[model samples]
Target: MRRLIGAAVVGLGIELVVLPLWLLPRSPAWGLLLIPLTLLTTPFWSLLHEAIHGSLVRDRRANDAWGRVLAIGYGAPFALLKSGHLLHHRYSRTERERTEIYATGRWASHAPGYYLRLFGGLYLAEVASVLLALLPERGWAALVRRTDRPDTITGLLFDRVRRRFLTQFRLDASAVVAVHLAAFLAYGRYGWMLVAALAGRGLLISLADNAYHYGTRLDASLEALNLRLPRPLETFVLAFNLHSVHHRHPGLPWHELRTAFAADGDEFHDDWFAAVGKQLRGPLPAGTLIASSPGVRRH
Candidate 1:
């Protein structure tokens, strides 16, 4: 009951805030509104995270329904998000993982350009990859060859990728397109604001993503890095900054995270701003390499 009510209120609030922002004028001051709006909508991802973990609600279907709704607001396909997230939890810090959200610089180059991509470029790359993923198999295969499976390509076409494209991608893609098209038709003149809102949200999400895993080692037990946020922001992000706790207790719901942290906060707490600063200042510190490379084709 608590989780459902809280998620409903937050979801409603994001829609209410975003709808009006689309009607605002396209001026410098108006553009600034996207920053707070981005913060306001950040919890949608948190709720989706809880849903993916099956902790948003006890009913499995209810969790998936809410997750799909929340993901639509953030413009992601829930099925793809679920698969990648599950892999994240299972592999934690290993290179076999398709997504870079939990990557530890273990298998790839972590140079300046790599950090730059992590900061913002990767979000744009995801949008492009999604479009490519929508293409016919032969067309996409021609563009992204069988031999070279880069992060962008692998993320969208890994193991269950075909199933996602056939079912969830087919249905969810239509819904996502319809929503954006409606928004464009209804408020085309203010389209810049919509773009700004999405870009701002992407920037903040990237910041949060880098802050969670930066400076951590590749060992599963030691990989997670927790950032201590203020009480309200911590609640808003559903204790995501307390990532180590989440990694440790994947079963706990958002509301109960504080209690778990109270009992074990010291184990993972790190300076939040300092961690963010570390990633932005330069490339990720070299991580200890794990054997069994992701590229070795199985016979």
Candidate 2:
């Protein structure tokens, strides 16, 4: 969580510092800063993503409790994210149900209008997804399974949050609306800074990550990476890009991913890259999908 907090501080502070500068009437410089700062949010969202998955916390509930705080900032539903992500882990490459690979031919990735969605104005996108996830008995049923632990905190966690969101948003459950509301109160047309810079950059990060990690590989384990980012870039994405180690030991928690990688750097450096070499841009290694760990069960 410390790593995530640090990234959030920087990612958000960049905006907080500039917003005040902009209140002084039209300043081109503030707008300029806003343009790129929005770009950085993609990475910011990436950091939030890993943190929500419990990597940031040594304790699961400790991680989970605060995960909602993160979700609230995004105006996102934790249940929605959890429902999809768990499905991704369960069936990373399966068709129709694959969140990673949108075989919907939407592969013509990121464009300008796509970026405008940072305005917190994209309606029905996520709502449709959450609803569709409930359409199949698989979707409805798996979502229900989360409630099996009635004796524990998970019950209150899922039901309360989900019910509150369901009642509040109804069919119009876009975090974008809250974003717009904040924008109206905060800065009018320019208030999009929060969404554009923060969420826009966030979407960029997700697309890049999705394509780099998911869009390319048909196989799950082969796509894993000890993704060593360049030094300065680490501040933007945090260490969350080091994805492979986390998968190897999901129970190991977030703080330990780097330590675990450090302990095995030599081995991953020597062999792991080539193992995943098939998924890269230029090179095409001829082979079937393979994961280094025989340990991960398909769910």
Top lDDT model: 1
The count of backbone overlaps in candidate 1 is 0
lDDT of 1 by residue, 1-299 (tens): 45544755564443434454442434445545556666665576777788889988789988788777766666666766777677667765554432333345442465546565656665554443345446676655554355334333353444455544446655765666667666655445666766776777666666666566654545353356667778888877777777777777888998887788788744444767777666655553333344334321111
**What residue runs in model 1 are displaced by over 4 Å at the alpha carbon?**
1-35, 97-112, 137-157, 264-266, 285-299
How close is every model to the real structure, measured as TM-score?
0.76, 0.57
lDDT of 1 at 291: 34
The candidate maximizing TM-score is 1
What TM-score, to 2 decimals, does candidate 2 have?
0.57
Extract clashing residue pairs from model 1.
Answer: none
